[model samples]
Target: MVKIDRRWKQVVRENSQSPLFICLGEKHEVHLFETYFKYQLREDARTNDVYLIHYQDFTDPLTYGESLLAEWAEAFKSWPQGTAAWPGVDFTVTTGTDAGRPVAALAELCRLYPHLAEQHIFVQIAPTVVSDFDALRNWISDWGRAVKKGGISKLKLVLTDHHKHQTYKKAADAVRFRIETDLTAMMQHAAEFTNPKKGDPEADYQQQILIASNQLSKGNYNLAVAALEKAVRIARRQKLPEAEVTARLMLAQCLAAEGKTAPAHSEYQLAITAAGEKNLVAAQIHMNYGSFLLSQSEQAKAKTYFSKAVDIAEQIGNDFIAMECTRLLGQLSEGILTGDAEAIRYYERCLEIAREMEPEKRRQSSMPYVAGILLKKYGEKSAAGKILDEEMRTLFGENWIDLTKKPKQMK
Candidate 1:
């Protein structure tokens, strides 16, 4: 449903009289324009015998003309030569060929079809159809002269290439397709030309990560997973453990989100193992893993990971991890409703860390929830309730008691 470029329509229209039309620009743009051109031709009432051929599909360039003739013979079987409905024969050839191969193929076609001289033969090539500009110009000129001698009606050639050349401009009606959109399709299409074989595998890996991130943001989980998989492979090949860990972690999260728990768990373990003794990342990964397990209701396993995360956080002096892991541990403990002293201790330790943080950070502390638990478990006159109420009042304004909403099952 993407619209073709307006300038391409204008250029094609303006060159209606020209027997040769050469499109030049980026590969995707030219390819898209080729589709638009074909659509325009098919819509015309005067056209019928339209065919498209990928030149690369033929293994041998020498047999290109013979192969094409065989294909056309089949078409002729379907629609007789005298049929007005199939009068003009039009072809769109997408090739990575230089001038010589196509010129030779055209010669063979002319030799085999003597009636070609008496009919209009239109051909188009997209993006990288020819190399050696001077050779192409000479071939076109020589072909035109030879076809003219045979009383040929008109032999049209539409060649597209990546570069602009004066010889091509002089030999054919050349039009350039400019890249106008920076959307996802265009971005992905552009990525198709990135050759990791040309050295710089890291660029390809980075591109995959970027593309995966974009896909993730668009909620295309399958595509994101595919891209991250490629990124993981690339990182492994590049011998970059950090990159591998990053990709695996992202892949794990994506798989987990999609409910593919087994693969997600595998990727998470791979990431954790790859992280090794990198405490900062290890702590964060353990906490995330714990959160994932908690979501799956694996409370015992979740507690184990949260405990490891807490130990690592304390070792690394990472207050963020310490606060988060401690809070999570408290939640897991309090979920049992066993009035465990351990749960209150975890919550108190988490609040102590949060209190030292900035006010903005302190507001996100688990202390408020601890107050709620204390209020629900015991009367306001209890020692724990009085102590928490005084602190909660300072954090949650004068209506702190009202702010405490008891955990659902606690009541």
Candidate 2:
């Protein structure tokens, strides 16, 4: 199973004060329960005060009240009235019979022992209650209303049900559950959030774009396309310019990956126009377009776009992108224009810039172009040959020598 790391704990703790809804599958309930208990214990340790209210059996309300009243009386010597203890901490237990009657019970508790209700921390355990879709919605709405009006600091509702229903799943803020017996499969399912709903549609659309990009990274092209399409529709509906541009770019990449060249080219053009000038997206647009043009044997047009990308990258002080653009330009000019000395010069410049940069993936990516330029300059026969050989080995491992086949038409 994937371990819940410190970062996950931080996220949950930060949101602890807020209303939390949870739905747990049977297999995972124990894990969720343990985590929840840990959170409470942590908070209590920090605050130096903790109160727990058990609601499993409430056969007699008077008996429950007497126990709570005695506890409160001992905590505060003389019971104060009204809103004096409004911000203090108090945990009150309630049963399934009290699930729909939270407000009424709260009012009764307040009238009888005003201090306890003034500083209420409700721990409602409704084991026998069977909540439908409407009940779930109403429960959440009521919880929100109580917090807004009554200034309730914490409200914890624990439901003991055999089957996990969609209603509870949708209402819960974050679910804490365990995975099944297969740890790998459990971890995978745990990684997927049950709720994808966002408060704002535009924000949700942007999230979809990110999800699509992640899917693309995993080589799930069809899923990526579907996500991108949904993101585009949402962006259009919300009139979010940045999101629309991003969706277009992602769609273009998906199309290119699928080898749908004509449509991909059209999409790239749209992305370039939508991204406009003086933006990171615009720089990427130029680079992608240049790559496409180069693949189609339009070296001159591709060179112009690559140069534009280089300029933009320089303006933004993005040395990696500048190096890549410069390298690509050199490749295009050399491959299609046949040993163009100017292309060799550009490649040399890229190498110089790359040498100054930190060691990273981009630095590694630039090595091939540097080797290509050396091959162009020294005719694969001089000291340049030794440099190329060493670089290929360094970049592509020992098999590099076997894989170093010359391009059929190195114009």
TM-score per candidate, chains pooled: 0.49, 0.42
Clashing residue pairs found in predicted model 1: none
lDDT values for all models? 0.64, 0.58
Candidate 2 lDDT by residue in tens digits, 219-309: 8899889889898888778876677777987798788879897888888787777777876878877887887777777889888988998
- Model 2 has a clash total of 4
| Top model number, lDDT | 1
lDDT of 1 by residue, 12-131 (tens): 466544445566655555666667656644545244334344342323333444444555555556543434332233333333222233344454555556565444456554323444
* Candidate 2 positional error at 169, Å: 39
What local lDDT score does residue 217 receive in model 1, on the 0 to 100 scale?
67
Error of model 2, residue 19, in angstroms: 46
Q: Pick the candidate with the highest TM-score.
A: 1
Clashing pairs in 2: 21-172, 21-173, 28-178, 338-411
Which portions of model 1 miss their true places by more than 4 Å?
Answer: 1-202, 217-221, 335-337, 400-411
